[model samples]
Target chain A: MTAQPDQRITISVDAMGGDKGPATVISGMAKSAEKNPELGYILHGPEDELREMIARRRGGQMLLDRISFRDARDVVTMEDKPSHVVRHGKGTSMWSTLESVRLGEAHGAVSCGNTGALMALSMMRLRKLPGVTRPAIAILWPSRNPQGFNVMLDVGADVRADATDLLQFALMGASYARNGLDLPRPRIGLLNVGTEEHKGRSELKKAHEMIESFADRANFEFVGFVEGGDIPGNRTDVIITDGFTGNVAIKTGEGTASLIGDLLREAFRYSPLSRIASVLALTSLKRLQKRIDPRRVNGGVFLGLNGTVVKSHGGADDTGVSAAIKLAFQLAKSDFSEKLAARVASTVELAQDEVHFASATQEKQEGS
Target chain B: MTAQPDQRITISVDAMGGDKGPATVISGMAKSAEKNPELGYILHGPEDELREMIARRRGGQMLLDRISFRDARDVVTMEDKPSHVVRHGKGTSMWSTLESVRLGEAHGAVSCGNTGALMALSMMRLRKLPGVTRPAIAILWPSRNPQGFNVMLDVGADVRADATDLLQFALMGASYARNGLDLPRPRIGLLNVGTEEHKGRSELKKAHEMIESFADRANFEFVGFVEGGDIPGNRTDVIITDGFTGNVAIKTGEGTASLIGDLLREAFRYSPLSRIASVLALTSLKRLQKRIDPRRVNGGVFLGLNGTVVKSHGGADDTGVSAAIKLAFQLAKSDFSEKLAARVASTVELAQDEVHFASATQEKQEGS
Candidate 1:
């Protein structure tokens, strides 16, 4: 179940997944394969069906040779529970998809399936890294930041995170920003009720202290606590919160953006005059769409696992799927998972150092 | 500090608060006073400064005559800590403003000072109602619900809420929705990471059970758990969460909305052609802006206290300040504070009844 980060070049794709079935998934892989020349896929699902679908949606025959087939007998449905999946998911494409990462056949796995099932199966199979209590699901949110997006984690990995788990989330999130967003020294902010030090849960206070103690050694700046309003702004590059808060925040952002998008479309076509105006501004509108499109930033990276897993939205189309593949491809290229594991390990060591140094200082004070 | 709901009518104003000083607060009062003939103000701030500002921004002679001044020397600054304000806030306008509510001189108080300071002072002076562990700050958020907005509570009252505290939030939020949002029977949803019964924090699960037990008696539909995306959608009228989560959800919503708004503006003016389109669709754009304007729905009502306190944003202008005053006016007319107190008392009773019944069952089982 162990593999060197170097042997993980191929990206595994769950082929018979998502709402659109194999057609959209193959189309998406073809799209990513066309763009990323070195990209290869260990396509999961019934082999004959996938080959047919990929040929139908083929961008180029040369790209087809890069694909290898892994036949899976079952597909995880949207209605399936995570508990059910964990018990009865032996031959499912999702199980086999992540199994490729665990067994070193692929560097990372990409799936457009039930999030709960994917997370459960991934956790069960990949297992948590050393010094990692709980793995986190980190997503890149569109923002007004210098990097154009902010990284938020524990989106829905687990419902609760203790103080130490939060500190680990901070370390993992910062590492993701460095590798994913390419930010050298990301500013990490703990999400809270208020920016004040005394505000929020005691867990956050403990997390704040823990994260700050390791901030210097972790190579990230601790921006202290940030309000939710800072998520889409340039206040911090990484937002660290428990899975419960992170899950709600991302969904709320998506819902708000979707609502605005619908309203804007209705506004632009409210009348014949407005319709003509929309036609005139079509190019500008498309640019705006591209800038804020959920599909463009479609992947949520599962951090703190032994291997990386990228989850595309369940309802993603070909464009969205391609974006998810692209993310998986990027993470697969770098030793991102190993680096994340190392970051978490070092942060824990640094925290223990701070505690040891503090006790020593207290002894010195008493001696004097 | 105890006053009957009958003695609550006049709206108290903290005139020296907000970024615009006394000018906007005075103007906002003038605006609200003009619309509601029965509405009266108990102005709290420096006497001479408020009088001078009133003279400068006087809307009508009738509005001016309706205003009654309460002279005070201190003004709470944004930099002031909540703890510090609680200690040395005797003569501050924000304190005096809520004191009016406590003294039955006003039914509700409106202030644009710091939220932490405002919340802390209100909690200290007004005191928590019977069986209420903590007070919650409820705000109206723009939504696609039938009422065009949803009531979300514990936005920044306290950072934590245990199971019982959350059930109290549900009862309080439902009552606020009835009076504030004017929904007779608002459906209440406990905010969680997921809607599944087995998902999220154990406190939420316990809160869900507690709230469900009293739904019929409370006369509100329990919509179970809701995700953050539901805040702006029509799935429920009231979303209840601990203050920490609620505050983050709200600010994140505002941040996302603001981000979309700026990007929309950029899109509309991206080119000369689009500029012409913008000119053509100016009316539609204005309509859209009016629809999502935070100023129109501009106050966070502090609930679970003996008296109502409406906190206007620190930087709110005349329009936003007026919106806060208008909400105070509505809640004051409805005997909301008394009704809220009653609701908490009754819900606490229901919880006790359930606890008693559970113990009785255990006793019977043991005897058998």
Candidate 2:
């Protein structure tokens, strides 16, 4: 269904599993609904507890009126393993949450529970798209681009991905930039150790050529290769790498940013004069903090799945939860799930044939 | 060559190849000499240029008395590839500089040239240590530990490393920590995507058991597996991974740190109030900047080679060049080369055996 400005969009929320419980989740939903009045939500939890909470609403009845309920007997705790969740999670809030998407009762699902569990449940219920080998976790990283962020994929979907998988990531990431970031001609880059013609593992080289071959029909410009140095910059709109490399890169960037932010605070408070300066510069500092805050960039979109599922950070409060909900809303409003499915299904065979032929020829040359 | 306090030590310097030319390299050496007067130098470059530059150095005849010139007709530029350098780099300053260490004319060598070129020349001229299939490039990362830094290796020596290579990195990194950082027993960690017991790829699991078995004889504690979040923190003294992961981690950390640093500066200059605050906080900001400056941590040590070589940044200025020199002198003074060779020679075979045995047992179990 196409998004009409006046038409209401329904979203599914797993309210029982977040760190701050339903209090923060409901508050975040109210804040989001204040700006997006067209939002209707399917709240997943024990209906009795949620009813009491909704009855005690601080805001007017507008937000309360938009919410509906689905009863899930159990909650998926943070300690639950992905395998365990998949095996025995039929009645749980997390499973019930994604079931809404599968049943077409909601456009998408959002959760602030364990990442592995969410991905498992989503993949099991929603299923992988046709021709998709491994689903990827894509997030928008703050960048020097005019759009203020860039797409990096397979952050922690799985630990390993082959050359073909990386090629799929490049295609999916390009589609993400086009639909999510609204870039007309998104540039794709394969992450490697160096930008030179001859560097990194054989898979990266293979993926480089694979991505280059498919750029024209895929409707994205392939910019050869980029290093980790390019991840936070504006040089490329999309970066595709294995889950291991991408995961480590994301955590490393976040760790370094947190360390620098801590040091900056300490430095600004070093002396009385500096303390006064800090007070004067508080607004500017807060602006920078808001711009780079991980809390503001909460959702990790599960790409290549039949239905979109956003995993919010486990410790996310109201603001983080709201940011994640916003991502889910935009994706749902744009009919992103259908667009992504069409993009992958239409182009998969062509990309696969190219890779198979390239590898076969490479094997022949090596044998000779 | 034990570290006797009063003994004079020699350090070889390639006074070419840096972006700023010989002026910054020489100035850095002079600064190091002022702090450590017993540092004798064998400066390599065109004799005419060196003689003119050294004569102009202040503090007069005393510093000059300790300096000697090694005439070289050429310089290895930043654009020079490693293969090209190995073939046509005989007379270049970078080649001549490392040759001095090979011939035992100097204890250690330092160059602010191309990293790929320097590693190529050093490996070719100096050779790998016994039992070492690969040599790693180790760098001192600023950390939350009281020692203020940690060791991470194989930054970019090669794009790939196997289980056996990772074992060697752990040993060599431990030695560098012991000799370079003065840690009696450095804690070594295997870098992976997760800290869970049964996460990440098979090689990581194999390496984990391998490192554990060698800890007693290697004389360093193994911290099992660590994620990228621990890179800047005090979790482990040495983080071991393949060159691709290590290189990306370093670059991603640097990129993120730099982006935050740039944002911090802009925050302090946003308005008139913040501008005044910037003036008042200038000294503190400078202190913080110096604390995390990449120039201050300029050298990446080439470990598991017969002799020590430090790769200063190609874009390093006076201060960066000096930091690299000081590291070389310290390694030389401690006889780091001999210690490293002994460490690798003694420990590599045992770790290799452990990996093979573990894989065999696992395969047998699977068949059963």
DockQ winner:
1
Q: Categorize the docking of model 2.
A: medium
- What fraction of the true interface does each of the listed models get right, in terms of native contacts kept? 0.80, 0.75
| Root-mean-square deviation of candidate 1 | 3.1
lDDT of each: 0.87, 0.87
- Cα-lDDT of candidate 1: 0.87
Q: Residue B254 of candidate 2: its Cα lDDT?
A: 87
The TM-score of candidate 1 is 0.93
TM per model? 0.93, 0.93
Q: Which ten residues in a row are the worst by lDDT in model 2 chain B? A: B1-10
lDDT of 2 at B195: 84
